[model samples]
Target: MMDVWKRLLARWAGGSLGGGWGVVLAAGVGVFVPGPEAAAQIVNVQALFDEATAPMGFSGTADLSLDWRTGSTNLIATRLLASAQLRTPPHTVLVVARGEYNFARDELLVSRFLEHVRYRYRLLPWLAVEAFAQHELDAFRRLRARALVGAGPRFTLFSQEEASLVFGVALMGEYEQLRRDGEVDAGQERLDPRLSSYMLGRVKLAQNMSLVETLYVQPRLTSVRDLRILNETLLVVTPNARFTFSMGFIAAYDAEPPATVSRLDTQLRTSLGVKF
Candidate 1:
């Protein structure tokens, strides 16, 4: 069992994700929308969602960042994220949405949007089941849209107030549409089945600080060479019950991407979060 686990981990590491995909996406989307314009739109949408919602066993956090600079070079960058979780008895639900836009010298450098929703039901102390759906769009990558839906089992490795670890495996179906670009075929689309697996861990680092790490792997059922991996690490500092400062690093890799796109994308973000 130990050797089997080691082999699995080695295989995962061998397919580690890369980070140049974002640069490619940014370059591709630069011509369609100006950076400042896109940033404004994201900010407006975030503001609209900031209004309070009636309680329904729901609690969440929201973050917004905006910056503008004026000089020989003018720059604007904005990001907004909102996530909510609902817990009722043995059932739990989570939803997240985020967008980012960046502009430098009046040109759009990056524009992307992502959303995910998940539902889980605890069937036993150590076992649960979950279903999830996700959507993504990145103008820079010339990804018109991608959608995924899946259901799977989640197993608890450890559970405690200050620390926890979990692993999940799911069978998913994905549909993707690609925009016509010089490099990618115009109106490209694919529908495929994939196997998805993930490990998640949370630990308390200090009295008011905590850490979370998650690693996800997805490989096309019909093509093992077509794989994707995502890893995210977050550090959160809570000064009080109502507010938090969080920094996160994300890395994503694709074994086979669109002709024009790179295989890896990476992002780092820091934001102030308010809890309701």
Candidate 2:
């Protein structure tokens, strides 16, 4: 029996059980056969392995909702959101897209869409390099279209099982087109340089619930008067491994908006999501 156990240990040390499973076996023994201090060390080792392996795969969420009302005033509203992440060890790619439409009295009240893609590569344990691109259109804001491309460095402030925070700064180039609204010119392209910074936070609120928040600020490199701020907050509840319910809020502000366009916009959303 002693020789058999030694052989098993030798195989485990020789990487015969695959990298993660050896750590799992060690953690199991630490938790079951040892004292509290050993358990803590096991947890730290597991976390290190998790960070190193990074769980290469694809994960995503999609949301769709519609509302219709008939009375003195008829209204219809539709919303759609989708986000996905593909992780390949030390590299990750992400995509997010959303659209909203509203109609009242058979006339369109609002129409807008936004899409973004980002890629990140881990350069060190707490540092990463990132690149991103985005496109947006809002008929209500008289924004015909906008495109942006950027690159930057991201730093992980903290990471643990219960909470995490990350911050990034980037230099971006933007191309914008506005509809002809008094002072604004139609079919005209405006290109500018901007500095952008963002902080993202995630926290576990309960056994089955989590909260995520992101704040972003962007200002023209030449003048701070031309600035934009965006905030997004979400609460998610999971009843099981495969399904989630979420409520989210988004607020955006522009210091210098196009003519006839509001400087501030806000939205509330609720969604049910499935995991695959």
Candidate 3:
């Protein structure tokens, strides 16, 4: 894993790449972490992987959200996200990190952090291979830690100037450890081999406007009923080459969640991004 990141950085430093996509700003979205009394926790990152303006060389974006209220019920919530990508021809590497905190009534309600790294190498015009690693911690779900690594081939099902579709599948090993809460074996540690599959689609509605949709499914190799699914849809509009506005919806479901947590969670977000 370290070797992969090392190679990507080496390649990025080897050449002088040009062009730029200005800084992107995502605003007006407050992250709400589910507490023990709330629904399940699912963090979908598909919308974070920007497909528009895939400038050659290097690009990055940062997002921040803050909400505060001082009334009968005090509340404060904040979220931060940072992402960087390096594209060198057939090789591309992307990294993302996000953190969230929510507090209400002088008590901490939720805290979460997530990190992901992905690398893709194109072998042909229609085929490519990808590998990714992810680590996460969520206090809302009583999850102390979760990690996974996977690699597999991706195919370009269809491609056009205005529309495209892609799909991929991989086998991944997942490890999870829950916080000790004495509720339904909350403090147990488990590992499972699972199949991860996804489909991504993009379509241009008009000049400077587009829609992107992504769906992910993961099921244990031995127990198909133990499944996880996530779906995200985003509508993006770019008035010019420097700014972007987007609204997205995410829905996630876990077949076997914590006894105290619900099976489904959903989120809606709207943000404007500026690029330099």
Candidate 4:
């Protein structure tokens, strides 16, 4: 049973964290958007916690992605993600941070930064209690800042060499500040209580290849209609122990978004990750 837990932690270490693909195609539009903009509120923090590169002690990973094009429209996009974890007996700690910038034809299109910290206590081989806090900002989304904190229990439905599934639910308290633009009561400070839930699954396709899927749903406790959803599917290819490559697709939706913000967003991205 201890060996199984070790295997599960090791598998989580391979998962990638925040940021999006450099080339973005807006949903419902066949053409690529001029800028690689995305919603930063829904990041894959679970990836940072799941990957266990080492059975004990501390481990870290860094991933960088860039897209640059020159010609009719000069464009540059860059993203960086870093994560570290410490494991000690029944207690584990994890931290992850990410930054992104995009420029097109000398104009800034996207800029965002995010930081997250999580702590977990393993009460059993198949169950853990977790608490987390996160802070994020996005220039494209006109978000000045957003912060949230939550705690809950997580259940490992199944775990094996070939596949795994996990589910979790939490009560989250959130606050946000948005930038105003000529709208009445725009940029107002807001606070809300939300129910956050997620499901994560992984499947090994081959000796060096695997697939991961994650889904997140957060609904306002006061009004279920005010909901947010995020989904990501990734195909990861590992050539060796230290390096990994992955291609992924992501989609996010907010039933009630801030003024001037779109309710839905999508992205297609590829990234190279290094673990140590």
lDDT of all predictions: 0.60, 0.59, 0.63, 0.67
Each model's RMSD to truth, in Å? 13.4, 18.6, 10.6, 12.9
| Local accuracy of candidate 4 as per-residue lDDT tens digits, 19-84 | 211111111121211111123337777755673335588888898866442222235667899989
Cα error of candidate 1 at position 256, Å: 0.8
Q: How many clashes show up per model?
A: 3, 0, 7, 4
Query: Best lDDT goes to which candidate?
Result: 4
Clashing pairs in 3: 22-275, 22-276, 23-274, 23-275, 23-276, 25-273, 25-274
Name the runs in model 2 displaced over 4 angstroms. 1-55, 65-77, 108-110, 181-184
Indicate the TM-score of model 4. 0.80
Q: What is the lDDT of candidate 2?
A: 0.59
Q: Which stretches of candidate 3 lie over 4 Å from their true place?
A: 1-43, 50-52, 65-78, 103-110
How many residue-pair clashes does candidate 4 contain? 4
- TM-score preference between candidates 1 and 2, better one: 1
Q: Candidate 2 residues 170-275, lDDT tens each? A: 7765656666656635655566667777777778899999888877777778788887877778787889867778777766677776655556656565767765
Candidates' TM-scores? 0.73, 0.72, 0.77, 0.80
Better of 3 and 4 by TM-score: 4
Cα displacement (Å) at residue 184, model 2: 4.4
What TM-score would candidate 1 get against the native?
Answer: 0.73
